[model samples]
Target: MERTVGMSRPELIQVADTVARDKGIDREEVFDAMEQAIQKAGRSKYGYEHDIRARIDRKSGEIRLARYLEVVDEVEDELTQVTVAQARRKNPEAEVGDYLVDPLPPIDFGRIAAQTAKQVIVQKVRDAERERQYNEFRDRLGEIANGLVKRVEFGNVIVDLGRAEALLRRDEVIPREAFRVGDRVRAYIADVRQETRGPQIFLSRTHEQFMARLFAQEVPEIYDGIIEIKGVARDPGSRAKMAVFSNDHAIDPVGACVGMRGSRVQAVVAELQGEKIDIIQWSQDPATFVVNALAPAEVTKVILDEEKHRMEIVVPDDQLSLAIGRRGQNVRLAYKLTGWDIDILTEATESERRQEEVRARTRAFIEALDVDDVIAHLLVTEGFYDVEDVAFVDLAELTQIEGFDDDVAAELQNRARSFVEERNARDESRRVALGVSDDLARVSGLGGASLVALGERGVLTLDDLGDLASDELCEIVPSLSESEASEIIMAARAHWFDGEDTAGDSDAGNDDAQTGSDDAGDSRTDD
Candidate 1:
């Protein structure tokens, strides 16, 4: 039996080497897995409670099996641990905590045990293989990968990338695109995840970075870092836009990306199934960049609200359809490329809207300040939209307006202040009628109008105000800034902490009274 086992030892090492090479795992790991499988078989043949272990000699491939017994002052588990006296009987000078190894004879292979060991080895090798794949691909994110289509199931393509496999889901593929088995495919490695089954790699053909990467491969200047891709927005399979910038002054970024007679761009378009691409020059100024992004259509005017990140684009009536593209694709791409909320308007529409705004502001001033249409129009022309602007504005500003002397400016400011006072008084009465508490009204940043708004929303007490988040308060009162609302809420919560401090003080006083009574009782007992 020993001669037969020795003869098979070299074959075991050869099998381990083959499995390690085929599965792309370390040979040492394979040996460790084999040893664990042998140890499991040995435990089954011996008693399950025994601590059996197995080792393989690296050079000679000889197998060794042993049972480990620990020396202890008391033996709780008789099979795995022995008393110090019993351990010393086997080998004198054996001390507590020493592990004694007992050699065991090799057992003949049984069919069931062999199958169990095979399963264990297979499972361990598979787990090691998955770990290897996950470690190799996790760092390769945001890169382009080329592979063959292994199979397609329900519109999702499974790509075989030689060393690993990746999935291209249906939504991630360009519209109207299809792939068949064994077809060559290229995609961007969007994500990689380690799951229970194995490592999963997700690929995308319609990702914005896919276009950027393709351009880099086509343009030498881009690959060499002379030109940089600033942004990309895609309506996949129909139209897309890319913004590129060149560090070299002499090199035209747009012309370089377009290539000689559009050869380079054409190659990328072909790979994407003829998706149309518009390459635009990038700019540091937002207005200039937006203008460039909305190419092939002239921009007559651009009104930007920097605080809101919104842009009102005015184009010629004839170019409205072109600027908006087929179903608003052009302006949509421009919005994504520039990170702006865009509203496209025709030149006629913009002009009409501006006139309407001026008329509206004039009407507002006439009603609020008790002024005539002529004065209101003049105020609107001077860019004073509301009574608050007239009330809080510099007296010099009003005097600077044409046809406005010091007396006229002074009268306007007085009326504006009176009107504001009356509005506040009215709002205060309404707030009181709504049952809003005075404590809530006294919150430092809470104005009469804000109190009325909060009361109408059923936030009628200090506790109610304290329970609200800053964003909820802003929703109820739009005029209050976020910081102001936060301050008001903090002030409302101050009373809650004050109550806690009062309770703590009361507890301390009661403890002192109890201690004084106990001292008096002790003194009386001494007397």
Candidate 2:
């Protein structure tokens, strides 16, 4: 049995009021939706194409519709057009193109039409609410906001951003940190998106701007407009390099950022999982700025290689290690801060100062390789002065040596092969003995012989290299490129060792073989 649920006109008004309240829509908007739905449904059901007008009484809650007609001298259509004479009978001043809204008797709306009207109004209300929310949030871009963590699924965080939801993906969050439901967090409004699923708000904590924000929070100088952050670069969770400048000459940007005993920087570092922060003084000159960026190491000079987009920094022999940092961290940070590829060198390589000393030392080392005296001298002059250095060199590079054809290069390598091998073994052993712990072998442009020579010359440590002027080293070894000297010297200092005897038994065997061969040759001639 079908149940009879009868609702009067007043009851329908109360239902509409309840829906408006529940959907957070204004009463007027609800009324408009209902009126439009009702007229459209009724007209479609009755198959009327001519102008149909509808109205709802504000106080009485009564609904009305009528066919509209315009009184015209020339009738364009029979249904909607009426002659002036006929219209004059209804109204005395009825003239051409005047519309007449005549009320028709109430027509019972069918059940299907009523159902269609209700559905359309409800859908319209929802669509309006979505549009209102989208417009409200769209104007909020670039602002910081607080959100509650709703759920974390598949490394993607869903946040309840008050009126709507936003996504805080894994990449946006700092590593190893998590948010639980109900946790209120602050993030920058990285992006706002509109789609079928409504507006998408993207939040980020790892953004470079995030670091800038943290600094702005801690530094009073920055807050008070005395200082401004020039730029920031981050390897997030590892280290960050920031360039800051002060408008007022009285304020030292680095000191202001460091705060007494590092209080200011420590706060930012704590939020970033103990990540190291380097606050550099910003300079208008790119060269000076880069030198500052590669801090804790003295730079002898900077040569900008514009074509390669790299800066070659020449440091003192001792400063090379510090300038390059452990595992190239210093140079890497410098690059990040300055937006340039960095190649570090010692001052000796840049200037023509240490030529005699490096050549004298290089000759001693290269002659031990069993190569021709001229080649040994050439190797030293060209900065390939050690056996291991020549071994590390590619065949193509060795061919670059004057008077060295492919065959001569091959012969040179063959003759000096044992020396190179022994030298490498000794270097490794020395590295272990002296506790030289760098991955310098990975650097393509540096020579192991030059590094060993640096070590032998008492430039045995990164601290030592970091202290020497890059120009001094460049001058000492005029044949070696400034970049090549810097690389080896820097590597040596980072992985320095002393009291290493890598040259022990290996050198003994080589000397013994040479003596025995001479003895054998003399014996054969006598027989």
Candidate 3:
């Protein structure tokens, strides 16, 4: 009966409102879904072959159903199209490719039809809700949020964030931390992934950024943008370090973050289950910052190996254990905080190593520069480690050293230069005997030294040079960059294919001398 369509018009709008509010989606979207469901149902009853359409009035909740047919010159699909000649009976001025709509009477739904319609509507609404949730939470990444622990399955805690469920995985939570139902939770929005099932809102309590955000919330100076958190490293519920900087010189960043009597840090520690926090002042100098990062331990000296991004921290023997912490946690966190590899040593160890390095440099200078032990020791103490430094330094810098006159400085420099010249000549003579190409030295990137070095490695031809990689070239000659090596290699490879046709022709000539014009095995068989 027609009453079945109109019986619950008010209930239809009410259900739309309820679903929109519950799903946190737009109301019009739900109405659009309902119309699509009704349209699908209409197609089932009217005939699946027909183009059935349905629409509900948003204001009055009135439903309209129609069967659409396009006027065509030829009847291709009879169920969806009507011939122009046949359409003239319904409308006198009908044209081809025009949709001819026919009003259809509403039909009562069977139980199966109603169930299918419900399923379609529910599926469409669910898809829309997922899209809405993804759009809502995608921009909330890197933000802190609060929710209620809805439940815990296995080890993953599902937090109900009012409108959506966020996942706090076991590994993302601080170690040994647990939660139960109905407990309040706070976490950083580490990631928000829109998956096929739904939007997975991943939360994290152990992330370094989480600690940074907590400081921003607890410290007003950080929130007001007066102080900035430069970096943070966490051992997660055990220990952590936060580096802060103050734009205002008057306000100390460390004092501001620590608050009065460590109130701010204590609050963050309480949240993290008593994780000891060291709020260190960030410095522009890496050595200074490393010293600050390794706090509560007196640093006697810091030796930096900048090329390797490593540091040697010399502490008092008694403070060595304190600086390293229990199970090397302190030094490990310092490495993370400063982005440097660190080695902690006592002053006694550093002194022994320093003496050994001095002895080694003295021996190297005595052998290379042909100087006496006292002069070699003097050069080493004056920071001249290699023969190249002695040869290349300013003549005045060498003369300025104690117990060295202009004649001595001149003699040392001349010997240094002569020693290098003799070495290079010897390397060059070996290179010439090795049959290394003179054209290799002609390449601008390959200097005399690099060419001789390559010759020593038995790289003799352009083809061999081209076949070599950039890193191989660098390993042979340490001064060349990869780009410079690549340029020279590509230049060497330029003539590789140039002589290909001639070489192939020569091979063909050799084949002409064969017993037969065939492959090697066939030629042998003919012979």
Candidate 4:
């Protein structure tokens, strides 16, 4: 005996409502999925060649099935198209473009057909649920999410975020942090991606922003925008540093982040598995910020090279290891936080280096200018390091030194200029001997010494120099800074574009040559 069970229309509507509510999707979408399932079963019961459609009444829950045929001048597809004459036999007002809908009889669904319909409905619902999950979490990136640990797969954690599943990769978790099923966990929503398998939500507990977000949750001032987090550098579960600033002058930013007796910062530390945090007040000055960033260690002096954005910090002999931290972690974090390369030294080392630099400058001055030790020491003490400085600087500056008169200044200037001229001639002859072209020598910001250096490194022509990157050129000539090397390379490559400019007349070429000559003169004077 064949068993046939009837489902009432209202019960169908109730099932759709229940599914939509439970799956957090729209009821209309569930109804459309149900209609598609029923239409598929109808096609199975009848011939697959018929044009069948199904709809459920929103108010009355009535099921309506129909076969639609298009009225055409002549029928091409016999099952889906009918002739106008044949269509008009059913209704006198039938036209060529109108659709003639024929009411379909109720389908007595078989067991196989019912099983197939259930599968369709289930798949459609699953698709809608995934879409909902993706859209819900995509906008929630860079936020803290609370979830339960669903399982562990090869050291990676799968988190259940109530409505969706997220992945916490093994590398993203704090080192040695373990999770078991049913454990409550919190993580930062690092990213969300839609893939063929499903929407993947990636979480991270080791990100620096995770600590920042945790602080924001625990500190009301941070959440209200009164205290701003400028930067954060982390060593995962071991240590971290945060730079914060205050918008209001009266309120201390570091104190606010630390809360009363270290409450706020302690909360964040607990969440990060006891990762020690150093909360430093941010400063607009790089030197001050770096000094504060390296805490628990006293700094004796600081030397900053503003052009290179590098700092050399000198500490007392006893404070060396403390300032450097264990294995240089303290200074490394300070470098990252301040965005500057840093070198740490003790007071004794710095003093010895300073004396050696003075001796070197004095000896260079004596050799280059043929001056006695007394005059060379006077020049070095007056802040003159190179013969070029003595040759090109204002005569008054040289005369201002003690025991120096106008005659002495003039003679020194003559000797410095003569030495520089002789050195330039020697370098030019060396460059020519190495087979370097005159075109490369004429590039702005490249002196005779730089040209000889380039030739020694096998850069012999304008095209050869133009093909080099800025750092590569810097390596070839260590005297040239990165920016200067870049400018010289760009100048060498200017000829490449001259062919493309229709308006590049002879006068334009002359102007370019004149500009290069003027820049070359400036470089010589500066040197």
Candidate 5:
């Protein structure tokens, strides 16, 4: 039987190699694990008090356990309590306190102990393999890799990643992109996690970097560094925005991506399942860049508020529908790409633009005023229409604006004072008969045009304004629809009534009459 143990060594070696191969562990690792487990079991089933060591002979299929003892002058522990005379009896040449390594016969561990040892060995081997796999794949994150679809489990796809299986979760797979069993697929190695079951390899194709990688693969210009993608934003399966720049001035970045008759972009679009791709030329100037971002729609102006990182984009009246896109998609993509909040408006909606232009022209006429075309545009943003409008503005309102310090604001206040005094003098002379104040004409904050409109409607004085019904004002002002007309009338009446109330407390007897008029006004305004 002892001879047979040595002769059948090749069969045992084959068994170890097969087990190691199946478990993806080194055969030496398995043998080492087995030796450790056997030594531990020997100490557990026998005694730790007895010194023990174990070794497995590779060629003999034999496991040897040896118990050792020191030849001591006096015995202390009974398990290894051999005296010098006792140790000399066994080894014959032992001296005092000399270690004696005595080989023991192969001891049979019962079925339960043997099974436990096997389980520990197998678990250790699996743990070693798992750690090795985890380390190998953990370094591969963000790299593109090719693998075969091995199987589908739960909702995740199990891919054979050469040395291990990678899981492609349902969410990680691109929309409408399918994988068949045994079919080769390319994906990005997103992550690797070590778990008790094994190392988990994660693969992804829907990541934003995946799109860049795909472009790098298909577009030689991008790969060769002739064209650079500056920025990209995507609403997956619907729309995508890419800003591209070119190293070669002659090469149009958008045209290069579109290819001949939309071939290149079509390929990428096909991969993304008909997702709309908008390719825009990258510009150093933010204003021009924004206009490029909102293409197929002409922009009248792009006003950048750099402090807020926002854009007030104005398009022509006819181009509003196109610039806003179907449900605001065009401007939305532009906003996302530029990382700015875009407020879109039409040129027609900017009612003060013409007046702003007149103010800029008037600045050339006014000496000591250093205003340019851009400042004129800024004035419109500040709601200053024409030079006349500026003539009526208060110093307080001017001081509120940025860069309009107390000194500069005071200068504007002085300039308006001359025009204001002249107009006020003329109106004060006519105050009793015409019932008008020249100060009203010089007030820029309120609507000077609305005052003129009220005057044209036979509102000659404050008393006339107080007497006019709000519904009648609504009917006269074509621009002021019913609700807007009522608001204006009530405001005018309140201004007139406030003056009347301040004149006398004895007018308290007319309180009921004032209340009746107010009720009538409220009824008309509510309509």
Candidate 6:
């Protein structure tokens, strides 16, 4: 026997209400979807060319199906438009551009038509559900989402979050952590994408922010704004580092994060599958902050290269392995945490390097100051790193050194000053000989030595300097930063615009003079 379904208005309303409730969508939306589906079936039965529309009464649950023919001054599509004269015959008052609805009898859906209507309703409901899921989860990004494991496919876990499903890619899950169906899992809402199929909610357990969030949850001070996490770096399932600060000094930010008897930090570590966390006290000074970030490994000395954002940490020989950790994980996390490139060295190694630098400086002094090894070594020991330092330093400073009186100090200072002056005069003359312009020498960051270096490299003119990029200038002058080079280049290019403005003013002045002469001639002619 052929299957038959209820066709009454009440029956249709009940079906819509039940579907709306089951699908968690608005009843009106469900009704609208049903009307569209009914209209599709009606057109298939009546005539494909006719403009069929359907509406369901919200309160009475009456289904009204109509075929609308548009009254137009010109009829091009005969199925949808009718001449104004023909339309007036039906209502006697119908004007052009009016729609006349012709009611059709109820549509008794055949097998093919019923299937098509069913597909349409299901598709509409599915689209509505997807939209709802996307809207709900988009605002929840960066928050912790708790859900049950729905399924596992090809190493990726699908989480059932009640209202929607989320994906936990295999790489996002912490190493060695696995989930089975029905397992209660918690992860960070890493992303939510509105794809064509549906909303894709990506969850992650290994993200660095996930650990930071866990700390915020476990430490009430962090959540209450008393403590702030400045930065976090993590090797998921192995180790992590966090730099935190506090506005209140008495609060002891690191202690607060550690909690009473290590309770607070332990809570976060437990959540992270026993990953070790080093809670560092953040400092405004990058050198201090870097030292703290590499804690538990005594830092003998820290040499900062602020321009490059790099630092060198000297530690004892035995502490090297601990400072580096297994496979360099500790230093790696510290580098990420402090945002600095770090070079770790042993104290013995640092001392050897220092000796080598001292010897090299002593040799340079001997060559430049025309002094013996003893005098050059003494100069190096007195903290004179270069001939410039010796030439510019106070004569009193040299006299204070042992075996040096006022006369000896005066003689040494004079020799240093003469050497520097001669070297400068020679270099300046060479720069002039190379055709280096005075404008090129006037660049703020370029010293005489740097200008000479540029001259040596065939960059002798203002135009040559302006055309050189920061990196290219750095090749000529190694100490030049990109910003410094940019300023010099812009200064060189300033003349280009100044010349244009100067010429424009001259032209304008000439035009005014010519016009004034013409007016004077006209006045004389009138006289």
User: How well is each residue in 422-467 modelled by candidate 6, as lDDT tens digits?
Assistant: 9889888988988899988877887778888988899988889879
Which regions of candidate 2 are displaced past 4 Å? 1-31, 48-99, 102-115, 217-224, 255-267, 305-309, 316-330, 347-527
Error of 4 at 321 (Å): 1.6
TM-score of each: 0.85, 0.55, 0.82, 0.90, 0.56, 0.80
Model 6: colliding residue pairs = none
Count of clashes in candidate 6: 0
Q: What shift in Å separates residue 241 of candidate 3 from its native position after superposition?
A: 0.7
What lDDT would each prediction earn against the true structure?
Answer: 0.91, 0.75, 0.88, 0.90, 0.73, 0.89
Q: Please, what are the lDDT tens digits per residue for candidate 4 over residues 243-359?
A: 999999999999999999999889898989999999999999998999999997899898998877889999999999999999999988888888998899999999999999989
Could you tell me how far off, in angstroms, the CA of residue 387 lies in candidate 3 after the best superposition? 2.1
Superpose all Cα atoms of candidate 4 onto the true structure and report the RMSD in Å to 1 decimal: 9.9
**lDDT minimum window of 10 residues, candidate 2:** 1-10
Question: How far does residue 253 in candidate 2 sit from its true spot (Å)?
Answer: 3.8
What candidate 3 gets wrong by more than 4 Å, as runs, is 1-8, 72-75, 83-97, 429-527
Best candidate, TM-score-wise? 4
What is candidate 1's lDDT per residue for 1-527, written digit by digit as tens?
A: 01222223777889899999999999998999999998899999997899998888787787888888999999999999999899888778899999877877776669998998899999999999999999988989999999999999999999999989999999999999989999999999999999999999999999999999999999999999999999999998999999999999999999999999999999999988899999999999998899899998899999987866888999999999999888899999999999988888999999999999999998888888888999999998888877889999999999999999999999999999999999999999998899999988988877788899999999999999999999999899987767778888899999999999999999999999999999999999999
Best by lDDT: 1
Clashing pairs in 1: none
The order of the candidates by lDDT, greatest first, is 1, 4, 6, 3, 2, 5
The CA-based lDDT of model 1 is what?
0.91
Off by over 4 Å in 4: 1-8, 71-75, 83-98, 497-527
Q: Which ten residues in a row have the lowest lDDT in candidate 6?
A: 1-10
1-527 per-residue lDDT for model 2 (tens digits): 11112213565477668877787767778778877886777577555766765666656567676667889888888778889998888777888878766665445668888788878887888777777666776787666667899999988888897767888889988888888888887777778777786667788877888788878888888989899899898877887899999999988999999999999999989877788998999999889999999887988777887655778888998888888887888888788788888888788766654567666756665566555567767777787755656666799988998988999778767756777677678876765455443544444453555555555566554566656666767765555666666765666555343313445656787899999999999999999
For residue 360, model 6's alpha carbon misses the true position, in angstroms, by: 2.7
Note the residue pairs that clash in candidate 5: none
